[model samples]
Target: MTVNSANARIFGSDADAIYLAPIGTPLPTGIDSVLDPAFEDVGWLHSDGITEAFTGSKTEIRGHQGARVVRTRIETPGTTIGFHALESKAQTKGLRYDEKEVTVANGVRRTRRGAGQKVSARSVVVDVFDADDITVKERHVIERFEIVPDGDRVFTNSDIAGFPFLGEIIGDYITFESSGLATDTVWNVSVTGTPTGGTYALSVNDFSTAPLVYNAAASAVAAALNALAGVTGLSGITATGTSPTVITFPSAVTLAANGSALTGGTDPDAVASTTP
Candidate 1:
């Protein structure tokens, strides 16, 4: 049996956060854009964690002659998010009581609920943190949803106040966007013959390095390549290994052979995603 630890990933909600905006507010352009000013962070949540529920109904089609179900059809597929806000602020309260009227007088906040009121749809963005608990791993965006209170508010000395609410997806369902991870370009640099002390030049992406000795160490070659000026994309390129020195770039880029001085360069794969 073989085990691969590289495929394992553990995610926690320690640094997770929820953001809410008006229905017409634009969704985040990318995972890094979740912090736009249009969205309001709902603050801390209960340790129970956020729940995403996908529900659907299935119907079986039966034939009278065979008396057996042949096909099954799904119906009313829906999605909802459940969370308990630990903060007792206006944002959470407004979500819980969508029809409540709020006013502030002398720095005193008051909310009043009215009869025969309707809940309004809102755009929600849920940020899930990575194992580091700081970087965003995945961003779940709901274009339009209605916040429905769980109608249960618990206030006790033993536990903190939790304002439970459910987000009923009204328009589009959840669209997931993840942070892009770029793989560095790598090249194997090999020296063919032993040179009796002569200077050689290395060129990468049209940028040439300063004069380097023919018998220079891999580390020295890496330093000379990294020290190349006037090219921003070529910065941070590294080299390692002996004979066939391995070079890596910060991003996918075209590599020049420098008249066969550097060879066997490979570009990183392109990032692609699809919407459901």
Candidate 2:
């Protein structure tokens, strides 16, 4: 009698697919798979039983239909596993365990460079917790702690020690508007509080169009002046305003070669305006 062993083949005449290895085996390498393991461990099976199932569909990729496989492993008492897709093919796909922890001991801190540093969707949010209390100490972004980086800087609890306590750091909040620009015209402006008591030059004509309106010209002038890196050095000086007709500085600025006060009527349509 011929006996079938481990390679026994059993199929009906109308079999549509072939079954290979037993369940729970890792699939072959070529198959695309995503895996997100538990925070610290894996294989935390339910106390009851395991329910395994798989479904397939034809999804459109580019212009052609591609077969997509979705497999689900459900544990009793309802624990749904989540899987994160691998970034590239070079990396192996499998469960990802995130059980890392951070210790904090200083004031939870963050920094901002300028007025443009506003929290947005992509911003990384950190939450600090008191070690013994298990209560949340603070929830904030890096901006609330400091201002102006010489170049690029990272706001991290790891940088400081003592006081803040060992805590958790959660990340990446919702999205927001990153950048944009609005162009307007400014006809008149006044600048004051220069580091050196000398004339500083500004000209709005280069940004002006023909037959410029008074208010638009003022906006352009204010925006141009505020854009200068040196403008921040002029302590007590104000060169920006929403009212577009006139740009006012904290002090008087010379408009022409005669050292006249920079004002609306005296605003020259030339490229060189000076502040003293």
Candidate 3:
């Protein structure tokens, strides 16, 4: 969620609905902005998984050829969100990209398939203290800062654990820029246990594809797993992850399956079923 000091509190404890506004459009006082809002009088945002998305042009040309004019037009997209969380959180003192520290034989930081995108992962210093770490929560001004995305690190000179630093400021609101671009529907499936070493077939959205052949090696499994991105019917589906790779499909897809001659590996599960 991109932060805006709008002083709005959406999804209150008793709220059965939400409000949405266009990008760059300011919402009313105490109202929050959702990803895609209705341009007509307020439309309903569903809590269920069903929706109707326009697949064609929403606006047409007007007047005759000599005096024709077309202003703004809305085109149908491939996917839509029935429900989404418009807000997110970042702990003042947690790891970047949420990587957990573990003690391996040589202090090497290895993560499971659930570790999140490696591009955003970084090691950090424990410079700040938490409430449990100290008796006082800083009775003074307990400074707050707006976090800059893709900027410098935070808490640089303070002897904190995670550093180099994304600089810090003194404020309560952290405003992040937002783009109206759409995101993909993704799911991560971990192939665990010993590989029986054989061919595995995959099925997506009821369309079956060729079998994926691999050995017991982890690298081999990861390679073959990612190759599913090119399947004919898989359209916008993309396969990612290592050890436990994720396959991101178009939001319209509802099912994906892996049937391999290999043994001991678990069936692919939705990314929601696993933590990242």
Candidate 4:
């Protein structure tokens, strides 16, 4: 968690929930500028597993989105009497995004339209925790981590020591990348454990041949996955059978920037990922 001098009192407390607990007689409401506040509103929304994230965040979650939990320790070990007492501690994760829309409302009959986006995230910082011995409670922060869809990684680890714990949370990090070849268009990615050595097959039925498609032959793409296997930089490309099981080849595939949604239910879980 990022820290600074502006919020030191609550620095060591594990950030839990974020709600504007207004401190005034006006019933503090959400302030737009420097004042004002309304009833408690959602300060953050995380998707550690299940969530329809149209924006961004960083989290290593599983099971149902927003159903997973991650705990962080803000209070340092060992405490003393009459020590520095925390007033309040809070954590926040910023979420940001953009979209197209109309700038102003009312005014002209035909107003020009514009583009825009919104960004927001949740924060998990320590709160006004007692400096003395109270109780060691594991503060869990719920967030989400996206695999960037295509070319997602596959690794080995423990239940809590899984790769997602170390991968998600970055708004820009790419979890998977082909050792060599990169495709500009895709849906999802899968890394099988079968290691095809060099042969592969495809579901020509999964793609649309309308207006003629690119490399219409599943055999051709499979051949490419095979041919590139032995070629420089293409060693990660592997060919498979009717249904790709385990294929290894060159590690050169562009995942996120080009991939769309997986077609025909291509399960990414079945693919066994590995290092380049």
Q: What lDDT would candidate 3 get against the real structure? A: 0.33
lDDT (Cα, tens digit) per residue for candidate 2, span 154-234: 246763211110111122212121111122222344333222222224432121212322333345544545564311112
lDDT of each: 0.66, 0.25, 0.33, 0.26
RMSD of each: 11.5, 26.4, 22.2, 23.0
Model 3, span 48-80: residue lDDT tens? 311223334667667776767756576753321
Measured against the true structure, the TM-scores of the candidates, in listed sequence, are 0.60, 0.15, 0.25, 0.17
Residue 31 alpha-carbon offset, candidate 3, angstroms: 34
Number of backbone clashes in candidate 1:
0
TM-score of 1: 0.60
Candidate with top TM-score is 1
Off by over 4 Å in 4: 1-119, 122-221, 224-247, 250-276
TM-score: the better of candidates 2 and 3: 3
lDDT of 1 by residue, 1-276 (tens): 999553354556465678999878888754544245788988888877888887778989998987899899889888878888889887777766644567899999887876443565788888776564232266778888788776578778988877888878876555553332456667665555444444556665456677665556888988988797633334566777665667776654444433233223332111111111
lDDT of 4 by residue, 1-276 (tens): 887443322223232222332223132111111112332322322223222122333454455767675543333232111111112112111111122332434753222322332322222111122122112112212232222111112334632211111112323211211111233222222433333232222322122112211112434444544442212223334434333233443332322111122223232122223333
The lDDT, on a scale of 0 to 1, for candidate 4 is 0.26
Off by over 4 Å in 2: 1-217, 235-244, 256-276
Candidate 1 global Cα RMSD: 11.5
TM-score of 3: 0.25
Q: Which ten residues in a row have the lowest lDDT in candidate 4?
A: 80-89
